[model samples]
Target: MKKLLKVLSILIFISAAAFTIQFYFNKTHPKIQVELKDNALSCNLKYSGLEGSVDFTKDEKNNYYIAYKDRIQVIGKNGKSCDIMKDPVLDIHSIDYSKDNLYYSSGDKIYRYNLKQGKNTVLLKNIPNYGDYKDSLLRINGDCIYISIGSATNSAVVGDDNKWVKENFYAHDVTPEDITLGGINFGKYRRGAFQSYNTRSLKGQIVPKHFPGNASVITYDINNGNSETFAWGIRNINGMDFTSTNKLICSVGGMENRGSRPVVGDTDYIYEIKKGIWYGWPDYSGGDPVISPKFKSVKGSPLQFVLDNHPSTNPPAPLYQHKNVGTLGSIAVDSSGNLKSKDCIFFYDNSDNMIYSSRGAGSPLAEIELGKNSIISSMKICDESLMILDEKEGYLYSIKRGKVNAGTEIGRNIYLYLLLTVILSIILILKNQNS
Candidate 1:
């Protein structure tokens, strides 16, 4: 009986020892936490107030020039500020400068101001009426411009009076002229004329024209006095830039009326624009099919439509996607060559009020938060500094990269030390027990 009891005690001890060893191994495996370099510079928003879109240019002397809605401001390397344009301009969408002059866009007009003479000239006018809405301009090389025209109405079904119209009205099959049957505005409206579709054509026979409020990119010519459609079917595209490879890139908004809780994870995209390519609007957004009953597939089945006629063998997806994040204004490239090997695209997120850097080869990278300030318009690289346009306060902010904070490094080191300590404690406990 004494020998049997001894054997039982040995077995119990071994089981406990084995459990301790396994726990220590799991605890000691190091976990890596991501850290970002802190932004060095901060903003002083006292000078300008409630500004709109902005653009930056460097003079021959390498001084920075910023054009804001209602004013043209210039900042020197020494942080000196000047009111370059004494008079105000309206809806200044974008600005670009050459060695001797500055060019800007306001609504449907493009203007050039001579720096030497301080005189402004209307280079192009009456390009197109945006129609009870203001448009944003993007410059494409020289003598060409891109503009985004957004949809005018909120989301609603064709012939329905609800706010926010879906992009694919054909799937709904109710022409813009068709009247709603049971809604609040029922029995008093015509067939098919939904809020987004043009009232002039509702037979479903004509190619749908551009949505009055849907965002579109228009290419305008200054030398030849002509303009053409560069791309269309965008829903309020605010951020636009070009990649290092000269591909036109844009950040667009997602479907607005899908749900009241802001449609979590509906998928907003960053697209590389190609000529004559229609991003699925009214039918799809973010590679997902928007279903409606109007289009025929099979009886008593949901009608589905895709961007392409057939399942795309090679559809271009977003270089990056931010679910439920609202992107405002424009993206800035690191033109100073500081991050030559990294992705050149730096976009500001309006939803989180952050600045995110994309890895050049189309990989998901880390996002850096820009504190609490809201940047509404654009960003420009000046020398080694990043100048952000703050639309609400009408100021240009200069931001620089600085040393990694001591707290961040210390936190990482402590985490490592804790894991090591836990492992050593377990080993010591086992050794004592064995003795």
Candidate 2:
């Protein structure tokens, strides 16, 4: 009995002490992994934040391109690069190549940079960016250039007489047909002011033919320089891509924590964007119609189609609905067979200090969980390795599989956990022997 008590006390004391040390002192360092909950993926820092949105180019000699705001640098594996163009335009959100020309987005314009001719041309300009939703992601597939535009305001419920709307629409030469063309309502889509949750009423609303109210995916035919809306009714979708099925998959970041961004528990999602369809925004969240929580109305629209802009047709469902993702960076498709999925979508949420990869449905799997409040500005996959830009440090990191670093969840000092286990085992052994 005495030996048993002694062993129990020793184990308890040792466990308590080790746990305290792990909790109070253990610090997370740079480690990469297949999943945030998994072991370390080998990590190595490469470039600075100056190397902007990472993408590979058609040019075989220069495999990758990074937009550094001031210039586009084409780089090789060993750090050799040449300036494609110097700050040709500031605020470049994304950069890519289509045949002979390079495509990049700066604010509302999709600038066509001719690689062969070495000249700059504004492919499409005067796009709308209302609220804090102006992170344009440019993707070029074949001859068409796709641009994902974020909303101008949170809900964009400006009254019919909003001067900004009139000016912006007129400047862009949007016609009544264009507004009504996508079955989109203009003038006022929302019934109430920019407050919390309000009951949606599409009745008695007036509008022009075309409504450029919120988020939209547009395509510019590089051959004709003519652009058209691909999809609409999205809030802020910075990370979107086309899958092998010729369909779209985008990470839609809804209602952020800010003024008028109603915290109705609306989370983030991976949207499968379809043509001529409105993926819910403002009045809906996570593929279901939702009454803004501010409305204080417990009773709301049905889970699926809450407030219908188009009652006849249902909005496309989310590919994967994530829980409250913020500051979503540009998305990349993983074709690196080394990864579990042949074609998986990966994105970073600066708000969560985590990177995510699409895993069918449910929650997007956390690929790499970063620490020290490291903000991931951009990410790109190269061969067996994944490269990431840490905005806070302005450093880029390359990650591949490595031995899992245990005790990250319990604490960073994995040795402590091991030592504690060993101590407990020895105590048990001694106690048994004594008995």
Candidate 3:
């Protein structure tokens, strides 16, 4: 009996210790984060006014290249600005400055513009423009180019009030089973309008169709010009990145302005893209099952017409939830020595106009405020600070640590740590006695 009691004591001790550690992490993280957030240094910026929807890329020589409207502009450190476009490229969304070429994505294709040769080659074509979300979010990995494409319809259903439904109403006959993301959990996602259409155009009577070559993210090979789907079912992953381990992580936008859905409190998400996993769009939001208005006992179109017929499985939860962040611009994993770890992700919300640094669940955030109504279009880490582009304000600003704010995060953190430790220790002691 004594031996059994001792064994139980040991087991309880270990389990309680583990639980307490996790509890401490969950508790102390936010408190420390609040302190750090409160004491966060205001943005220190070297401002340069730019024009249009400016996208930036830095070359090896540390020169800043900006693509806007109809030209490619290069701004030198000595305050000289020059246009470098051989031809005016309309609607320049993304640009990458490599040693051999200047790669840019516009319209329905990616162009590899050879600098010395002065030639343009079509790397990938037939890309989908799903409403306005098809901005061709682009980035250059080692030997390839990655781009994100959004869905074709709102909430993957033809609602009575949607504008797209009124226009392309005949194009889609979609169900949940059409998603087919090729994973363990296939039943969770309702594929959108882009996934429903057979082609960009309709030939005969429009029925439900799967748009060919329509994927969320695609990789373009520079050598042979072959492109492949990196992942799918991201809904509208506006901004994405290849991490240090080359794994894709992206920021997904929530559905808003849909005639049938709620708009104001919609939640956006940032996720690490595990290939073939669906990040619950149209069917789910903010790790919770999206309650379609039609699914309610309303005896209406959404309920009586669609919900009973849909067969999609459950969708996956997000890495982090950003409440009220409607349109996310760009996501960069910060390696700068700012907070605790280097893998923390810093993402900008164009709608919110704030830069948030987070590492999934139970991690602290270091938020830097920008001016109100300022749209933080894109960001890049340079010299341990963020080179932020406020496209609406037409200014390139720098955000970095100045002086550590008034109260100390360190001293309070230590006190809380000890307090939690003592509380847990006392609880464990009581538990042992009862056992």
Candidate 4:
């Protein structure tokens, strides 16, 4: 028994030592490789080990500024990182830079960080922050900042799909325009549209619109410090950018299968953001009624329109539609003319880790695969290179104009830590049984 205990102690010590070394190595040198080619565009690994990075933007001098959940940093062209803001906000989702200011969104607030003065000011606040889709995305155009706020509930009817209701009981989806309830309730709770899970609504109930509403896009004029709803009724826009011609483009996430009004076979969309337009939600997807047989789940009843009368039953269709793309993410328009087109568009799909580019809406070209186990959390075009952030692996890759090359690996496999852990667990179990 003494010898057995001795052996176990040695094994445990060795395992701890190995784990420490590997953890340090992974932090210092992350693994990265690339072998992506799509018609004269060659993707390459630029930077790795971007811990906690969700979004990044480039400044006028072409320096990279990265947003990490609570803080932001600037990576100089010399490859050195300098902290710009430390623990200033929570849940940082998107970031943009203009003139001497760094603009970013976190929680229910948008902030502006003056670089020269080293001061951070809240530009907008009290944005709808509840529900599964609270993170907001922002893009700056001239003196205006366009912000996209996601819905408080899936399909506007709060149900079991909402996990935040236990904390914020009154949290529910709000509209940007006055809407009349369709006299429909969802689930046993009998919750009505735009009402809390425990609340009920009357048939033909008039729900007033509120500023800075959920599931809508609003514009903030930097000059006047005023915000106005740019568009409404859009479900969730994961990414948005402006084309060279100054047209706003967005990647809209489709309805999921877990909501009270479950919708299946719904297609994601690429849209040109138009002012005051109702890009259908809860009723229409891709400009088609949810009551259509295509959206019905096999094990569930047919889907119904959550709203009786939509602002427009026939909303404008998306510029492009993607079926089974799986949670569309960050989008970018090539304003630099790198792809030799007027405004080449690129968007990422988190489900498959594929980046698809198209000359226009209908001409989606072959996708560029970045390898396995990659979750592209954010993407942008900077300095004629497409910068992709792989949040799962803490890697940042750049796709530029180059010759196609085969995939290559550098550094050790980080998963070896997991293997060591499993082995240690087995040894402990065996020792306990023998004792």
Best TM-score among the predictions, by candidate number: 4
Q: Best candidate, lDDT-wise?
A: 4
Instruction: Tell me how candidate 3 scores on lDDT.
Output: 0.59
Candidate 1 clash total?
32
RMSD of 4: 10.0
Error of 3 at 201 (Å): 17
Instruction: Tell me the tens digit of each residue's lDDT in model 1 across 315-429.
Output: 4556667655455446766644554333366777777676766654655444445445455577766556555666654555555555434443444455465566556656655
> Cα miss at 62, model 2 (Å)?
3.7
Q: Write candidate 3's Cα lDDT for 42-93 as tens digits.
A: 3443445674755787776666788786677777776677877746656678
Distance (Å) between predicted and true CA of 362, model 3?
A: 2.8
C-alpha lDDT of candidate 4 relative to the true structure: 0.80
Native-vs-model 1 lDDT?
0.52
Which model, 2 or 4, shows the larger lDDT?
A: 4
Candidate 1 Cα outliers beyond 4 Å, as residue runs: 1-55, 76-80, 86-89, 126-133, 140-143, 154-201, 207-214, 222-225, 258-265, 292-315, 335-337, 360-363, 392-435
| TM per prediction | 0.61, 0.67, 0.67, 0.83
Please provide, for model 2 over 214-313, each residue's C-alpha lDDT reduced to its tens digit, 9 standing for 90 to 100: 4778877888777777787777776766655656777788654333223345677777787777675655656665543422222221122222234224
Better of 1 and 2 by TM-score: 2
The residue pairs found clashing in candidate 4 are none
